[model samples]
Target chain A: MKFGVIVFPGSNCDHDAYHVISKHVGQPVEFIWHKETDLSGYDAVIVPGGFSYGDYLRCGALAKFSPVMAAVKEFAAQGKFVFGICNGFQILCEAGLLPGALIRNKNLHFICKHVNLKVENSNTPYTSEIAEGEVLSIPIAHAEGNYVCDDETFHQLEENGQIVFRYCDENGEVTDEANPNGARSNIAGICNQDRNVLGMMPHPERACEVLLGSDDGRNIFRSLTKAIAAHG
Target chain B: MKAKVYVTLKPSVLDPQGKAIHHSVELLGFEKIADIRQGKYFEIALDATLSDAEARETAEKIAKDVLANPVIEDYRVEISN
Candidate 1:
């Protein structure tokens, strides 16, 4: 299956996602510019991490209005897979494609390090290859990676099994110290109610290579292709 | 016409920046201050043709839809001129 990586101004990780999808995943991938309004030929779209629009107004706030986002929204509405990583997750939340908002880190500092995450739900297309409760080491880098939602939204997410991943210790235990960003309920990633749109603050592209530290993230890309094949 | 919009974090949301500011205020010997909250301020210039009521409505719309995220922030719009 082919994948498209959306490139916005100040998007530094678009190339990284493109490279991983093309080389490692052995999939045809293209870079979709923010101004482009077409996403007709791709099976999945990846909104990679970076400071889009210099993170003006707020992180992902300005980028949410980009021309490409309209197309991305349309793509998701069609049940096509859409994966948002890091700042891309923030953008998705800002665009209202996903629930909740990412606020400033509780420590008020930019955190850049690898953290352990437990796969909470593996039924979605993105995490199908990952076993439930499996710990994956993924790197997170952002000043506003704290995920927050109102009590009602949180309850809905919980009831729908939309919470896909949670921050956890190496032994797969959820703990406050393991929550690098102070996200509510230690949530690190979540999918929309339909389970087609996934947003996560951790950088999966950065963790796909074994030499880089962990190859655990490869399961996500592999699972995406598998899901596409099944759908076809 | 000119309008001013003020955007602030919702009361239920945590504000780390505001907390830091409160701590700094205490460090400066302002012991009487109980809390501090940070917010965004924007000055918008509107078309001169619009009447006062129209400008106010436009400013409020902008403040609610663009300047502030209703999920995490509350906003108020005031016509400046």
Candidate 2:
């Protein structure tokens, strides 16, 4: 499967994402700039985490209007697979590609550490390799990783099984201890109504290598590759 | 024209930052204060001669897309004509 990782000026994780998709998933990967509008050649698109635009106008505010996001919206509308991690999640929310918004860390400080996330629903392409309620250790680093949504959207997400992951402990026990950053409902990730677009605050790429102390995140990228190949 | 947009978290949402600030206020001896909730304000300068409808549209767009996250925050725009 051909993958494309979008690189905004402040994107600090594009290379990490590309490395994971290419080396770990063993898929063809490309880097697309924030100003570019063409995305016809890729099977999947990823928006990696970073303080885009210095987090000045909110995390992903100014970055959402970048030219590349216009194409991303079109691609996402076509049901192409899209993943947004960390500030990428913020960007998706800013672009209206996702249902919820990422707010300041309830603690108001930059949190940088590993977190355990439970796979709430493993039916999607992103989490297909994992069993329901399985836990994966991944790192989260952000000041505005709090996820919030109105009752209507929140209810719809719950009803449609849109939530994919939530903060938990190694035993799959929900806890605020390993959460690092406080998010509503201990949410670590979620998808759009269509489930084609996913936005999560955790950095899976950071955990894809065993040298990083955990390879649990490799499954997510691998699952995407498998799903695309099977569908193709 | 210049307008100030106040972005505040919804009542149901938890504000850890505001809570911390409240604690600090009490420590600093403002004992009579019942509560403290924090908010952000942005003073936007629009170059155009904006009509009421246009101004409202801009503010709404910003509130929905930027200045505030509609998921957790309710925003108000005060315009200076």
lDDT of each: 0.93, 0.87
Candidate 2: where is the Cα deviation over 4 Å?
A: A176-178, B47-65
DockQ of each: 0.84, 0.60
Interface DockQ of candidate 2: 0.60
Least well predicted 10-residue stretch by lDDT in candidate 2 chain A? A176-185
Candidate 1 local accuracy as lDDT? Answer: 0.93
Off by over 4 Å in 1: none
Q: Fnat per model, in the order given? A: 0.63, 0.68
TM-score of chain A of each: 0.99, 0.97
CAPRI band for model 1: high
**Number of clashes recorded per candidate:** 0, 0
* Weakest lDDT window of 10 consecutive positions for candidate 1 chain A: A223-232
User: TM-score, chain B only, every model?
Assistant: 0.93, 0.88
Q: Model 2 residue B15 lDDT?
A: 82
